[model samples]
Target: MKRILLLLSLLTIAGVSAAQEFSGNIALESLIFSEPGLDASQMDDNITLSFKPKWTGEWNDGDDAWSVEIFLRADNRDEGREHADIRELLWLHLDGDNEWRVGINTMFWGVTESQHLVDVINQVDQVEGIDGEDKLGQPMIHLKQYHDWGVLDFLVLPGFRERTFQAAQGRLRFPIVVDTSAPIYDSSDEDNHVDYAFRFSQTYGDLDLGVSLFKGTNRDPQFDLGPGIPHYVQMTQVALDLLLIADDWIWKLEIIHRDTDPSAYQALTGGFEYTFYGVYDSDINIGSLAEYSYDSRDEGQRGVFDRDLFVGARLAFNDAQSSELLAGIIYDTEKHSQSFRLEGNRRFGDSWKGTIEMQVFSNVDPSDPLAAFEKDDFLLLEIARFF
Candidate 1:
């Protein structure tokens, strides 16, 4: 993987140099724990640094282009977290409204505030954060076509990427470290399995609709403790995502029905966001978000948001600093568990910015899935300088 990434980086750098269109950034991040015993090591340093560089170029009047991004960190707390990745390394060709892309790229789908049930193309960078918002790029041949009916996307994934996991010394992980090195697959070819997907999306007036199908290994891993190791199970999934825009209110819905060997179930996440613009003529915007998530599985489920309600608020100052604040709470009705998160960020001049985030878990029952993270509350600080 290191050799492949190095080669790609060299190629991307060369291409960007030839095109003379280079841009990137330098970022510094620090994580401070509110309490100890979260990870196995309370003696490690609380502050760490990471470096990310990105470059992109285009030719033939923007019809052809290439982009690459590299992430590197200095901390060695968790072997999986303190690593490097080629977040994006793709070549794109455009013809009218149709497009073709080849290489590793990241894609997102779904229209919900709390969870993304229909977004399954890219693997999650689990070690990055617990929100599951960060993703690792996947190698694929992607095609997008536009028509009168809507837009259709066809993806041919030649290789599968294993999901990252927290090591034993990681803070936001279970007591027993999941061994992601030797993952088992249902297919004989293992990581070489060819996964494919199809999606069709359309927008009519203020309503947007999307339907998708995926057939291959599941992104979420299922534990196999019999062999005293962790592995993943293969599954097929079909999903639907919908969004409705009405004035200052937006409604979102995501439903997924999947089948696996041991069990087959359906999951749903429905929500809405209401925003008030220019509140009191102060150039401040406030938005309220409410969502409900459900899973067909009973107790001892693998996920934390099985029967949970999520309520959140977002505040945007819309000033020269570009300041923003977001606060949210997730309440599990079934297990009587709750989690809260606070996030804020602001820009300082044209080339520098900073961010602060905090997460807290409360009222967690022993039987709840989030019980492991009860003591993992933490605060994160990040600053970046753009070029």
Candidate 2:
């Protein structure tokens, strides 16, 4: 709360002194479960109201700028889902080929569609979604240098954010409630541990490549079976991501090798998407996607995506509403389990937008990580008003 007040105060001061821009959105979301949850305490339906506000100011003829974005959500059923975050509160300075940024910020790094294997900068906001796409902001000092050969980035991260989990009464949650109050850590500094990362990215012809190195506390935590508390470990990781653009085809790959206290493992996700422009002589474009994921770990220790295949389709309607849809299914090769997902969105006039999302799980094996969610299939509908 204090941080939010400080951010608002800064924005108010900036608005009085510099050129500023403000924008935001309010969204209402409804989620319905296909079946009753395994736990009797879980609810079959849930509603959430969310607000996101952003403010930006520029001075010195755009050479120096600062921006703040805040996200807040209120959930009817789960207190864990009701949260607030400073998605971005940063100052950026640019001078020729050098750039510097400091504050809380969100960073994304990956190329594949099925999963993001090389993105480890921020902690996952698990209560937001199960897809692992939502992330919490990280406090960091970022430096970038642009050169003819490539771009180099260095990050000094000071604080760590623990991943959020659903409450015991929340739907789409694990069988055992996660006790996040007393998380264990490998480092005595715990959440105060400092982390560092460096990345170099370059484009050669049709291929764009990035390689990164990180030494820090692992973003993904393992569960202590006895207490059901999350345990963070210190580790070093090397990651690579690449994209190749070929006419109507796009190929993507993300690979990572992480070393921890007692073990080391490598994982990779690779995929390709082929697009058909103006299908059937219409304004609609269709894309076909296929991806494979692998992990070098035991079956029980691996993630749901380990040794899995994902096939999906993307549709784009070149209309005034800018409608788009994506549907995909991930099949576990060894376990014979499947997860189906569908997402679509369309703008209603200039100020309103509507979205639909669905997820279904079938034949989940007990050994798979998603076994707990086998009966948690759900459909979500959301509407947002933008200013």
Q: Top TM-score: which candidate number?
A: 2
TM-score of 1: 0.94
Summarize candidate 1's per-residue lDDT along 1-387 as a digit string, tens digits: 477468757866675676545666667777776677555564233566666677787899989998887666655566657767778888999999899999999889999978888999998888877777888889999999999999999999888888887666777777667777778887787888899999999999999999999988888877754442556677889999999999999999999998875788899999999999999989999999999999997567547879999999999999999999999999998788999999999999998989999999999988887888888788889998877
What TM-score does each of the candidates earn? 0.94, 0.96
- Cα RMSD to native, each candidate? 2.0, 2.0
Residue pairs with backbone atoms closer than 3 Å in model 2 (clashes): none
Per residue, candidate 2 scores C-alpha lDDT tens digits across 1-387 of 456567656765775465378789999999999999998889899889998878888888999999888777778679778788888889999999999999999989888988988889999988988877889989999999999999999999998999988888887777888888889999999999999999999999999999999999999888853556889999999999999999999999999999975589999999999999999999999999999999998767787789999999999998999999999999999989999999999999999999999999999998888889988999999999998
Candidate 2 lDDT for residue 4: 55
